[model samples]
Target: MTADATKRLCDVVLDETIGRATPDVEHERAVAIFDLLEENSFAPVGHDKGPYKLALSLVDSKLVFSITGEKGEPVATHILSLTPFRRIVKDYFMICESYYEAIRSSSPSQIEAIDMGRRGVHNEGSQTLKDRLEGKIDIDFDTARRLFTLVCVLHWRG
Candidate 1:
């Protein structure tokens, strides 16, 4: 995304009720939070203003995105089904595992090949998320990519 369209996130939080996450999941969440806050585009529908705070969690079997103003007032909430993302997320996790394993002992060329595949899967997940949130929330490709990773981290429990 261009610098002009970027909207910084004041903070990002995950529901503790989701239970403890694995180290890998925690690392994904941490990087997403850091990168998302550093640069992102998140403007709730009908509200052109931003510098928002986002809280992510699973409610029942749905993914919930709770958005609030920088001061903590409610902005909007979007809940999405996991059905549409199942395939891509599953593939992403599988490829991630392969990438990690490959990095441990594979040749540099092999590792690069796996990394490329991992990035491809990640891009697919990001595009799917962007499509799913089409009218509800407006986010750029980079923002969607990072958000997708966080969603995958949450979905690890499922």
Candidate 2:
């Protein structure tokens, strides 16, 4: 956890529109949220709000981040176009599938190679997220990585 409690997220909620996800995706979502809550730095720019709650959703091909105070008071809402992420997200999923298949049948070295590629793609997504959220919200790399995982979750159709 960061030293400033005010900058951390206390809770996270994905819009009901997200509906049901596959068990694997559900697990990923659960872990991402849990890890985010455990340690993250998220502060909405120009707002002195502390201990925030987040509501993430996809609406009209946009990624919406709804931030609120601990008691649910509105803080900020940042809506980003999903266009920039489309290709990268698709590439990420491809790498993930390869990594999973490698895990089941490939040799240890081969699996490691695929895993490295998967991580590289994940890092790319995280950097893209940070770039998109540049001025709207201040978050660390680790936070961006976790949030990117959630973004991938939004794209999961299963």
The superposed Cα distance between candidate 1 and the true structure at residue 37, in angstroms, equals: 1.0
**lDDT, candidate 1, 1-158, per-residue tens:** 33654255778998875567778877766886887777688887788667788888777778888999888889999998888888998999899899999989999999999999999999999999999999999888998998887778777753
The per-candidate count of clashes, in order, stands at 0, 0
Residue 118 of candidate 2: its Cα lDDT?
Answer: 91
Q: Mind sharing the TM-score for model 1?
A: 0.87
**TM-score of structure candidate 2:** 0.93
Q: How high is each candidate's TM-score?
A: 0.87, 0.93
lDDT at residue 108 of model 1 (Cα atoms): 96
RMSD of 2: 1.4
Backbone clash pairs for candidate 1 read: none
Query: What lDDT score belongs to each candidate, Candidate 1 first?
Result: 0.83, 0.90
Q: Could you tell me how far off, in angstroms, the CA of residue 129 lies in candidate 2 after the best superposition? A: 0.1
RMSD per model, one decimal = 2.5, 1.4
**Worst 10-residue lDDT window, candidate 1:** 1-10
